[model samples]
Target: MSNSSIYTIQPIEFRLDLKDPFLFTAHHIDHFPAGNTQLGPTVPSTPEKPYQMYYGDVVPGFPEHPHTGFETITLVESGFVDHFDSLGNSGRYAQGDVQWLSTGNGVEHCEMFPLVHQDKENPFELFQIWFNSSPEEKKQDADYKMMWREQIPHVLQTDSNGHQADIRVVSGSFLNTDALSRPPHSWAAAKENRVNIYMIRLEPHAELTIPATTATSTRFAYFYNGPLLYIDGQEIPFKHLVELKPDTEIHLKNSDQVASIMWLEGEPIGAPVAMRGPFVLNSTEELNVAFARYRQTHFGPWPWPTPAPVFPREQERFASYQKGVDVEYPERM
Candidate 1:
């Protein structure tokens, strides 16, 4: 079937295996020089926060983990994720709730679900966005906020074929309305990297279209539930982001079933982005500071690292226990 995206890929004509294409699995620990970081007889405190996150081919459950520098945007499509951080805040958002966690300076938090309850016939799906907080906000008090399904404003977008689109702005916009913009900061008005996040629903064989965003932006498109035959002039490798030329309108379709796609675009913050294990920093010095703090149990909210879990200290003992799944050790001679 010929489908059209915002803009067509010109039918460049590439062979694709929409049913099951090859994918490179991701990592809980994204280290430099690629591959896993060296581990000691016992993992350092930072790595043992007692959490398990689902990576490609990994069992899903989380004792939990820590993060800093960026905001985590979570949108639930089916199941739910209960989050508890050092701030003593706990909430389980499911089926149509969105949660945003901004860990600016630093924070020790964990994300996990006690069980996966099935949704009326659909499964669970979500998009976790990591946005860089302005360098200053990073060190401020940690914050947790959840917008319920009803709280999310709904607007109908229609394509030429009576396909009605339902959209929710987790943060950013729909025309003149800024329903989910950030909580006010210089970055909000500075106008550097414009990051817009949206939750969209498409009907069977339906088409959702959008105007061209820009040339220098990066778009992370994922189909958490259902399948998408994203049409760019040509047929793209199905189920994968068919990168289009800049200023190209986007046309997407739900062919296999009622598909759902999360679209997030932003200007590259262009900061020194460095991450290792649980810390993300701009310099080796900052990384060292994070390491020492975990080693000394000194890092906490408001000064350098933001406080994430109010009860992290209680889990200190289990923090040393690691099931140690398939750690992708670096391939070296």
Candidate 2:
């Protein structure tokens, strides 16, 4: 729908087309069956089926891959993810966790979704967003950081009708709650950038108001889950994205069923973007240079034994940074 408050409404596919300052976003929801000895689904995923094994056959995920000139923000809503990168960082993070990786010049990373459970179904859901980096920031060294579920901020609000709205602040401030710190070289590092990513859930028949930001910022609301939703009293269907006016307050009213929405807003980078495969750069010439560099260095050699490494079945949520001390979280019940 086109209006003064909304620019466009588009149906969401596997990969979402985002605007400046944001390159790409995809929502992955896979209902994997029991795992075999290889930690992959007992029933292999086919192209026409609901389950997708993307790049890995033994393990259902992308293997060692290169990325440049962008940052990956992975939010795991349901299941766990095993992350291995060339910088010698590894981690196993689960539901409610967020992994922010700045690829800087270049980095090779493996994201394997291990079906930890062997006896029952293993359902996994995650949202991965590719945020653009400035020309200068793209040349810095790679960095990886994890925001555990405990460290991230979650806020709850209830309207006069007592219907509640649950808000998870992933990259920006919501109400009085602030998100965890981002990588130093991230485009979101600057407060003036006004980069914000929020995951909001509304109870049945709930009403919530999204506060306004600067007019210069770009804003979008994606109605990903649940039934009907009303934005500023306008009906919004499921699996649809609306480009919102950043300077105006927006009201969201959910139907009788619970609803989930992903809200992304940020000031435009206003830089020329040239993308080729996994490389994002300013010009085509720069992308060519990135490709040549990756071929020459292989993004600093993969230290892990296999491109897709499956951690022990009993391993809990933990992070082993390249330089920092390794840390482990309490085992989930």
Best by TM-score: 2
Give the Å shift of residue 221 in candidate 2.
0.6
Candidate 1 least-lDDT 10 residues: 16-25
Model 2 backbone overlap count = 0
Q: Candidate 1 at residue 196, lDDT?
A: 57
Model 2 Cα lDDT, one tens digit per residue, 1-333: 545788888898778888989987999999888888778889866664468888996889999999999999999999889999999999999999999999999999999999999999888999999999999999999999999988888899999999999999998788788888999999998878989899999999999999999998989999999979999888899999999999999999999999999999999899999998888999999998889888899989898899888798888898888633655564432
Candidate 1 structure quality by residue, lDDT tens digits, 251-285: 66667466665555655555675667656566788
Q: Runs in model 1 with CA error above 4 Å?
A: 1-60, 116-123, 183-192, 224-228, 236-238, 253-256, 301-333
| lDDT for position 200 in model 1 | 73
Q: Candidate 2 at 226: error in angstroms? A: 0.8
